[model samples]
Target: MKDILMEIIESKRITLREQKKAVPAQLLENGASEERKMFSMRRALANSSTGIIAEFKRKSPSKGWINRDASPEEVTAAYQANGASALSILTDTPYFGGDLKDLRIARPEVNIPILRKDFIIDEYQLYQAKIIGADAVLLIAAALEKDECLQLAEKAHELGLEVLLEIHSEKELEYVDSAIDMVGVNNRNLGTFVTDVENSFRLASMLPKDMLLVSESGISSPETVKNLRQAGFRGFLIGENFMKTSNPGEALGSFIKQLN
Candidate 1:
């Protein structure tokens, strides 16, 4: 049987195709060029004391409906006010209960970099991200071959957007390239949906020393962030812990205070 990750990617391809038909790539390019400006997630994380990339997500496939009615403006503004180094907004509507509109809504509310959290497979999506006002885009190594990953990363850079390459295992490290801005190790296994924080710890040493490292997914506590920082992780992508709460910004504020 096909795993959930594969299923989602397949479905995403169909969705992308349909979307491309509705809004041609040329149109996307024109709109992208008219965008205000792009922020650097890498620079923000490097300069921050906490290096927290607070995410805005409504739901996930594994847990289902984490915060169904969460507002982007409210939650993201809170994240910024609470010392978030950056912002990540999920734009996959089908599985993640998010839309591109979420990022658009949250963009004006925060000053830090915003990462467009999606399974980016096509170049069109990169243009869409630029047009939608995303600072960076996620490229999952598990979803694309090495060449495809490189092509996307290069294109993202060409469009003046940063690339956050996410890898779950050691083999995926080959996806790393010069065009990629940051390397993110996702603790959750996309195939099985099993989460293990140790994955980040285990893979930390294998990454390039010159590359900025980020630990993504399953990071909940300040203690875990401290440990990961000791293990050489410079950035942390946290979502569920704050998003599941009644006030994500206040929760993030409290979490940052604990970190300090």
Candidate 2:
């Protein structure tokens, strides 16, 4: 698993470098003016009881390919309609089989906040996030140092984009700060590639009170969400659970009905 993770990291670096030189400067231009309106991820979570941050992903490393055929527009619309507080769109291409185009296409279709769920290493991606009209960006604590997380969170904030700092364990909890708008407990162990909703349960009480909170990965049912919410998780990030089905919209509709 360590070897596989290293390969993923290397492949991501190669993809980033190749993409940087091929794309036009104007296409990646930072639209700082559009940064005026700030949609609060914390506020969204606070207002919702269910607090589901439904995700639209094409594929993943652990699960391989899932639903590459679903359009971003269709998925985002259904997620919003099914009581999702926000939308998480995977934009990494190599392993996830996702791209910025997927995120951009889903932007105008939904009214709720959109989270660009990608492996962000450089500041350039934050600007790219704004260019593609992303309302928030996911920053993994395991992938970055404390200082790096703070700097990236600040950059994303400057662009009116919320930063959801993802932590996989108690050790990573030290990186949390005011710069981040939310803190997410990724239930899946990226190192071992194992998932369990109980990971969120173990860490829920340790999270800070002020920031929005989310539980990511391994969330497949309303019962699991209920348990997590009871444990004080204000947000839930669900990915392949819905997209794995043939009809994601109906899949979401049924799950949401059960949730209610």
Candidate 3:
């Protein structure tokens, strides 16, 4: 059987081929040059009370069709106004029901850093992220080799974009390079699609002490957030918890309040 992560990455390659033809690499480079001033997600998470990177995801392969009609502008504005330390906007269309338009729409509405949540396989996507007004990009360890991850991280930093390296297990830790600004432990197993928050706790002690730690997925409660924080996690990326609700921003606000 084929793995879901590999499947998404292969699909991403096909999509990127078409996108590059529609908008050449040079054009993307030009657009990146004109992007607004960059924000530091690392800095925001370090100083934030909630340390929440509120995510705006329409859907996922595991959970389908989550708020397909949610407006990025409305949701992101609410997230920022409510106390989101940063923003995460899914830009993958095939499996995640997101597009670059979502990030573009959300960019002007919020002042916080916005992470381009996608399966980054090549350097072209890094330029695409910069051109699309993303302050950061997610590089999944399971999707790329160690050298590829390091190269992508270097390229992202050169373009003034931060790299949030996502890892699922301890072996993936080798993918962490000096260029990575944040290390996120995704609790959901990409192969089985099962999530356990304990994955964060299990891996917390193994992560580099100097690197900022972020706990992603399977985090739904303020108590969970508080516990993760106590375990040395500075960032929490929550999506389905808030997006599943009728009012995601308000949901996020309530969650943050509970944390305080």
Candidate 4:
């Protein structure tokens, strides 16, 4: 599994670099002419009571298929309308079956900050994220080295994009730095595809109190959000729970209504 994950990471990096180089300089120049866009998930959460960062993921390596037919606009708008503070758009292709176009499409339709939820192993992907209208990008600590995490975080900051550094366990806390805007404790174990909300609780005490904390994966109920919030989490990233339903937004609306 380690070898497979590494292969997928490497392949993603190569594909992103090539895409970056292929963009014409003229379009790049025009896009660069405008001031860089800044998306502050921290601010979004600060103003919302629920602090739900609703996600728009089509598939996953572990889950195989979540919702391949759902439109990003319909789902994201529902999340926003239902009091979601922000949106997480999975941009990883292949296993995730997501694309940068999803981010581009969702950002313009929704006002919330859009997270480019992808396996980012190289710095070029940060620029790619910005060009495609992403408000922030995910940096999984389990997949990146300590210096790599810090370096990528700095690059994302310079690009005016927020960095959400994800940790699967307490061991990944060593990668945290000032450059990271938020720290998400992923409850899902990528190696075995097992999920437990307690994984987030177990690592909450290990994170520095100065950092904004988020819990990702395995949150399906309002009770789950209440419990995680009590454990010091400021945000919750939920995807499959809503995506698996026939109407993700309506389901999210119902979920938030229950939360309130």
In model 4, residue pairs whose N, Cα or C atoms come closer than 3 Å (at least 3 residues apart or on different chains), thus clashing, are none
How many clashes in each structure?
A: 0, 0, 0, 0
Model 2 agreement with the true structure over 1-260: per-residue lDDT tens digits: 37455576677788778878987545665454554344566788889977878889889888889997889988889888877888899998888989898888988887788899988887778878888868899998888889999999998877788889999899999999889788999988777778888888898889876667799998898999888877888898887988999877778778878998
Instruction: Provide the lDDT at 170 for model 1.
Output: 83
**Candidate 2 to native Cα RMSD, angstroms:** 1.8
Model 2, residue pairs in steric clash: none
Q: Which stretches of candidate 3 lie over 4 Å from their true place?
A: none
Best by lDDT: 1
Among all windows of ten consecutive residues in candidate 2, which has the lowest summed lDDT?
29-38
Give candidate 4's error at residue 10 in angstroms: 2.8
Distance from true location, Cα of 34 in model 4, Å? 2.6
Go through the candidates in order and give each one's C-alpha lDDT.
0.93, 0.83, 0.92, 0.84
What value does the lDDT take at residue 132 in candidate 4?
81
What tens-digit string does per-residue lDDT give for candidate 3 at 1-260? 55788788788899989998998988878777774789999999999888999999999998899999999999999999988999999999999999999998889888899999998998889888987789999999998889889989999998999999999998998887688899999999887788999999999999989899999999988999999999999999999999999999999999988999
lDDT of 4 by residue, 1-260 (tens): 36456767788878867776797545654573367456688888766788999999888887788998889888898888877889999988898889889888887788788899988887667777888888888998878889888999998887788999999877788888889889999998766668898999999988898788999999998998998888889899999999999988888889888988
- The C-alpha TM-scores of every prediction are 0.98, 0.93, 0.98, 0.93
